[model samples]
Target chain A: MSDIRFQCIKVEQLDDIHVVRFADDKVMDPARIEQLGGELQRLSDSSESPKVIINFSDVKFFSSAAINKLIVLEKRVRAKGGRMRLTNLRPEVRDLFGFTQLDSLFSIHDQQSDAVVELTTK
Target chain B: MPADADWIWKIDQEIPSRAEVACGLIRDFVEKLEDAGWNEALVFAIHMALEESIMNAIKHGNANDESKLVRIVAGFTASLFQATVTDEGEGFNPADVADPTLDENLEITSGRGVMLIRQFMDDVEYSQGGRKILMRKHRG
Candidate 1:
């Protein structure tokens, strides 16, 4: 129902869950990734027990540095008792997460609607 | 670059340790691979591996010092890709890096770059006390 803008990510609010998507096809730049981390952190901190769903439909490539940012964001969301889910990860990026054994730590969904339903139902 | 050639495009250069320079080099490498008709999966692997290696050299190794230069030598055939990245900064031992996969370290933000390079590249070795990294990938 609402929108928030960041240079690297697009935010859309569907009721209580915020659906976030990358504005760039490739989220590789470290400096830009930092900005993205900051923006996501701010959003997580904006509400009590924020429910966020990160949609990766637009991201084709992202560096390991970008992965680091996501990990940091997850920690921030958790510290605030918020929930975060990642959906629509491209195969390469998804494989990277598996390689690092982070697939167990993060909640990943193959579709955005699944994540939204899960987050909302919970 | 030829599709059937043993080795096609190759380059050796020392560029300033800047993100933009590193990106430009990666862009050129990907373009060469694409021009030679490399598959999307293989291209993605090489692109991800090179991006991590070169960026690590510039950001971590050189500490973003623009005066410092990172040396890169790369060549590829239709089936194989190889590259070496060397930075001027004092290197740390790769063994000392904590495994990010461990539960205790899962929340850590950094230290995943080296692991990614090793995962994507078929052969990866560090020399010059980790200041230099050699990576090779075989096309599938």
Candidate 2:
């Protein structure tokens, strides 16, 4: 009854990269993280091994659970010789990454195009 | 700091459905505290503590069984907010939980909740039964 729905996850193939954009409230809710993990796992299982771009512009709050799930997704992507990038992070959420010292662990970009450029160049 | 600002509430645990209702009640309580001029950090700390305690009661104490009961008690003073979550299940050994900070466990998913609670709360105390946790946070 909470009406807690996750943003739509759109997977678009940009050449060899997969751009996964979350289009809903980016709050850290356990149920939403589980669903996101499921989707990421499905994509990772495929043989294409595309670069992953997680667009976080729509997310406002960051939770430890969501961060943990992101770490899992990062590991999965790395295992397949692919890289994970985050883009369009709000300042508050970005501060969370900084607080957690995860800024060094993942590639972050101010714009989606910048993330795309980084992935293409790599 | 106003006098007579302290408040307390207690409820028994049920299924996640009932647990959610408890969460709602706690959320309302926190909102009321915020309206009373409690700082943001204390409010956030209370919210986190409440969520963690309720989840532990529902998942670990009741083992997700609807029949089991979990109890939560919360109190706030002018300088500190305290909460206790107790479950009906046979308690767990806190020492048995692996150190989540170790490099080997960094990628592991499950053990981080307790670590987060410890980090976020100013004080954390566990009873031998392993079913009860008392957490507190102070206002800055």
Candidate 3:
């Protein structure tokens, strides 16, 4: 068990939405990404399928594996008629999305409140 | 020469957590260099190089088999930092990778690792049937 401590998940409720904040320095590892996917799937399986707001405030690195997992999460959320919004992207992390041209594919915001509002509006 | 300046670590590729373990080792190396007042650009470059090389070993070389071994070697001198990653799997041709910026390949999900590695490193080279990569960055 490595001592790399990551605040991996934070589930908060704002009205009907579920804000799942993944605060971590290294969110790109395959194991951690898969664990996140499993958690998201479990959350989506519940009777209350609330809109999701993903906070990326603390994430500084982005890996293709992590992006793939998020794409899967997005598809799952949309299949349930809910949406996922990302927030608080650091510049370097944001550049990864831009490099893949996925910046347009995801709904991103500079602020958590903004992302929460956008998710609820949809 | 500072103590622990020539840190080198080698591990088998069969470990399921090799990537994380390798990254941790490189991070410690970079931190030590940074503490020695190494240039920030050099540190960032080396960090990206280490990441891409390790990822290639994990994803491409080992094919995520968890049965193969990926060996990493890292060294630093007063002027330059160099690292090498070698995998146990059969090597693939690096020339076969297509340009991700091409119009038809724009939507592809893969092929970004090598490109990023080349972009960030001062020098990048492959060897031994494409199973090994040597990357270096110089302090400015």
Candidate 4:
């Protein structure tokens, strides 16, 4: 029912938890990141759903600008009294987070189903 | 430092310091690296490092001035990948960037591009008075 159109992300909802799938397998610059930031901002402002899940199964390469958008989105969701989790990270993406030590900051799950189950259960 | 590459394709091109142009160049560069036989992870590393360096060249270095230019040069061999990005602006000292691991800078995302580039690439060097950046990654 959402009229919102995101250039880089597909949105779906399960109960109160909103799931977002990144459309591109690789992003080389900030254009997609900026678009994603706008979409995530809209999601945060929506009263329909609070909990969030981000699925990254299709994404492989990204810049820190994308990660910056993620941090901003995380803060926005927290400010809106909800939480977010990341799922389906490729090994390289996982290693990127490990190198940055951001793996300690966000809740990461192995698969989209697992993330949904956990977020919906909690 | 790059070893003697078996086959190297060099790109000496200039962009008008536009973000969209930069993105297109990055994508083309990524495809070129893949065609050079780099595995996914190594290509990803190169892609990440390239984006940071080129973005810095366009954004921070050129101050987003369309009149400025960003130059990119990159090539790869079977085992090694090397790239350089140069900008037309006053360069800043890389040493001035705070350690993102520090408590105060951990949440600040803007400063982490340089750090991430350093983290993913095997060797990263800044020269040309810091307006130019060189990044290399070795494949296993």
Candidate 5:
């Protein structure tokens, strides 16, 4: 586990892949979302070639602002030659990704194990 | 575009340009939709659309100015949902928004709200120089 603590996310290290899970079931609050985004960005910035996997198993709902934050996080990770993936999206949340065409923009997996395998093999 | 009487439930209020207050209003509406027997998927779609619309009004349209207010008018029936959100700020041009789905814009953090609203809602129209947005969804 990483020493960094985040109010909105819980991070666990699996070799080089950091699997992150959100603390809130609803990622709709703007202030919290901003804080969450800041934390994720910091994680990406502080790490060397970070490999991240965001697990959405607990998140029931989120707004576009949250999606915006994820996009920003993705870019930040990629800019540093890191990789980020998402997993365990509920059908509704996955539909939002499809609606925004973001499903194509990010590497998404059905399970954390799958993402771990993909990231580890890459 | 049916008569106002067609709606079984309606809400009209001017709220402060605050995210919490706006989201609270959306939650109330979602609860109402649930009480009215809208299925989970439809409720989720409506909730997402309302969330984006109101947030855009408060964050972008009103610029989070406490003095500015966001006007929301929403009506719903078992089969239909309709809403109009207007903000007290200089309106923007929706057409000028870059397509977030485009390769170059995909990394951009903003500008996806409008597209999501349009995607989830069956019908959406912008007027009053983009200060006001009208959205409608039909339960399927």
Candidate 6:
């Protein structure tokens, strides 16, 4: 139980949208999911209309725990009157979302900048 | 490590506090997977599947009790990879979990894992009254 590594998630403001990027090249581990959940909680609580785009360009794989965290985060965001979406998902990630049918629940786009554009426009 | 040997481990620990312990072991296993012809994509799938399965074993199966043991076995062939995780706890019926894609259940957090397990792996089956999960992925 000695080995533990936290992937740093950086949030940047792109106009009105918040672009949250994960430092991990591939974030499928539950520990990293919990860490991202913490960050999402803080942001969800603080922002009034956080048009968020979770950048997953660096994340090649993720587990169900990660999706659970996103679901919780989406709930919190909606509770706060904010809109959220996902962007830059790898092909595998997109397929996973499609299989789970979660892709229907959240708005997904191809790129982060494009998501920001749409978020600000909407 | 040749492809003939099967890797096995007994997880006698709780989750969240020691989930990383399980994850680290799996990561090292995947690192060795390259020698077995598992590419980056296949390794990614195997890693994610193992993580989700092990977590479910400890968290949901054992109820995060350190006293229970979660037995894990992993192996890979030339074009296929498989792993199984069996836990020491009462299991639930998979049918009991609602479809996560449904509009009403979109916000629910529990079903995502089961869904992801099915999506990432080529085949997923539950046995031992749902206490153990066997998953396999085929290399492209």
True contacts kept of each: 0.73, 0.05, 0.05, 0.73, 0.78, 0.76
lDDT of 1: 0.86
Q: Rank the candidates by TM-score, best first.
A: 1, 4, 5, 6, 3, 2
lDDT (Cα, tens digit) per residue for candidate 1, span B2-42 = 34457788889999998977888888888899899988777
State the lDDT at A44 in candidate 3: 63
Per-residue lDDT of model 2, residues A1-122, tens digit only = 11223344677778777777774553434566667777667776664565888888777545566677788888888888888899998766675566445677778999989988888886
* Predicted candidate 1, C-alpha RMSD: 2.4
Q: Enumerate the candidates' DockQ scores in order.
A: 0.77, 0.26, 0.18, 0.74, 0.74, 0.57
Listed per model in order, the count of residue pairs whose N, CA or C atoms clash below 3 Å is 1, 2, 3, 0, 0, 0
Model 1 CAPRI quality: medium
lDDT of 6 by residue, B1-140 (tens): 32454433222333332576677777777777866667776777777788878888888888888777788877776666777788888997888878877888877777667767776799999999999888888767
What stretches of model 3 exceed 4 Å from their correct place?
A1-7, A47-50, B1-17, B33-45, B64-67, B76-80, B98-111, B138-140
- TM-score of every prediction relative to native: 0.93, 0.73, 0.74, 0.93, 0.92, 0.84
Give a tens-digit lDDT track for model 5, residues A1-122. Answer: 35677899888888777888999987888999989989988888768788999999998788888988898888888988999999999898999888778888988898988988888887
Report the error of model 4 at residue B41, Å. Answer: 0.7
Q: After superposition, how far is residue B75 of candidate 2 from its true place, in Å?
A: 4.0
Candidate 2 Cα misplacement greater than 4 A, ranges: A1-29, A43-47, A55-64, A86-117, B1-5, B8-42
- Where in model 4 is the C-alpha error above 4 Å? B1-5
Give the per-residue lDDT of model 2 (tens digit) for B28-106: 7677777768765556556656766676667667777777777766667666677778888888887898976665666
- Local distance difference test, per candidate? 0.86, 0.69, 0.70, 0.83, 0.88, 0.75
| Docking verdict class for candidate 5 | medium
lDDT of 4 by residue, B1-140 (tens): 45544646667799998999988888887888888788888888888888888888989999999999998888777777788899999999999988877766667877888888998888988998899998888889
Badly placed stretches (over 4 Å) of model 6 are A1-7, B1-17, B35-37
Tell me, what's the RMSD of every candidate?
2.4, 5.3, 5.7, 2.0, 1.9, 5.3
Index of the highest-lDDT prediction: 5
Question: Residue by residue across A80-121, what tens digits does model 4's lDDT show?
Answer: 778899999999998877777777777899898988888777
Candidate 6 lDDT (Cα, 0 to 1)? 0.75
